[model samples]
Target: MRITTLAAAAAFAFAGSLALAAEPAQAIRQNLLALQPDMPIESIAESPVAGLYQVQLAGGRQLYASADGQFLLHGYLYQVQNGQAVNLTEQAQSKAIARQIEAIDRKDMVVFAPAEAKTHITVFTDTDCGYCQKLHSEVPELNRQGIEVRYLAFPRQGLGSHGAKTLASVWCAKDRQAAMNLAKARKDVPAASCDSPIAGQYQLGQMIGVQGTPAIVLADGQVIPGYQPAAQLAELALRAGK
Candidate 1:
């Protein structure tokens, strides 16, 4: 009788293991959606932390959930090993940002590059922002240091506003770089219209956590919010490449 009881217990344990192992990621997603139907979930994958799954939402937001989808955590997850703490969340976000940025064609950007470009940075810029104007003023110096600067429009005001119209004019102008310069100098851009990616770029900026103008995204997908001197930015870009 004891032997039979032991075998039954073993069978139950095996079945439990099977149940845990078969918990589908889709189930977790469904559970999340049930809670927040409006939240845009992008992807789900197993996290470094045991029993936790990483959930990536639209616009680079991240969260963690239990394998069974019973609990969800909304914060950064750190892995501590050998007396060092590594931010797993930031690592994942960086990779996502890199992929999204790579998908952008150079033709869509106002690019300023040196003859021998060593590195490039993408900037989400606004025409009327003071810091963006300051950053644009340093573009010549940045170009001299072999760092290409690619500009994507991100008007602080939302679509259909005056700022957006000005940026759309810049994109529509025959010489985008010249128009950008004029707009940054507070000069009125000639009214022009085209099939522009300004709105998409603005949404992309929001997804990637861009809160202000002149947000610089380095080759390594690190975002530097606000202005940095030309030399300092060049040095940082070079170091990131290494």
Candidate 2:
């Protein structure tokens, strides 16, 4: 009886919204919550698609909803332009990711760059990750290719784990770049702690969909999971810049 009553009340609210959808955005939000009480909304904005609204949900999920809140779309939205298909959805996501990554100041990150790097990549790394160590080894090569490599601490083992403590130590070190090298080489770094962005960076990685160590974010905000050869990575960075 409880379940039936709740369902009927939600149905009634949705029916009212459908009849008075003059405020599309509000109607969408209200009806969506009525239908799915667990889903949380972050923002709603007008979309390029006529009569549809873009809904950004908590945890970085996105979707398109009908003006009347009668339907929702989960797939990518694209348009044909100049004989080519442009993925509007992907473009938006990339721009948003780029903005979030750019919000982190370089001074807080361990940076390796040539004097005249044309592009940069932000990597979420962990000292205990074997592939992350391998990736660090290729930083010099990437720098030679005119691609800057910036490191953000992401302990794959989660906060308070051994990996997180090691990362915090690296961030807290006087010579962060040197400390990073030592830690990546499986050497002990003097335990230290101060105002550091280790936790914040790790949280940012989680918000942006980082699943593992050595996750790379290109200049355009496109995420490349896993390791790539220096030559290949440089090529990709250049392409993303263009």
Lowest lDDT 10-residue stretch of candidate 2:
54-63
**C-alpha lDDT (0 to 100) for residue 228 of candidate 2:** 92
lDDT tens per residue, model 2, 1-242: 99999999999999997656548888888989998997768777778888889887643557899987889999898999999999988877777788778888988899988889899999999999999999998888898888989999999989889999999999899999899999989999999999899989988888878999899999999999999988889999989977
> By TM-score, how accurate is candidate 2?
0.83
- Clashes (backbone N, CA, C under 3 Å), per candidate, total 1, 0
Tell how far residue 72 is off in model 1, in angstroms.
0.9
- TM-score for all models, in order of appearance: 0.88, 0.83
lDDT for each candidate structure: 0.88, 0.88
Q: lDDT tens string, model 1, 39-129?
A: 7888888888778899988766798998878898998899898999998888888777877887898888888788988888999998989
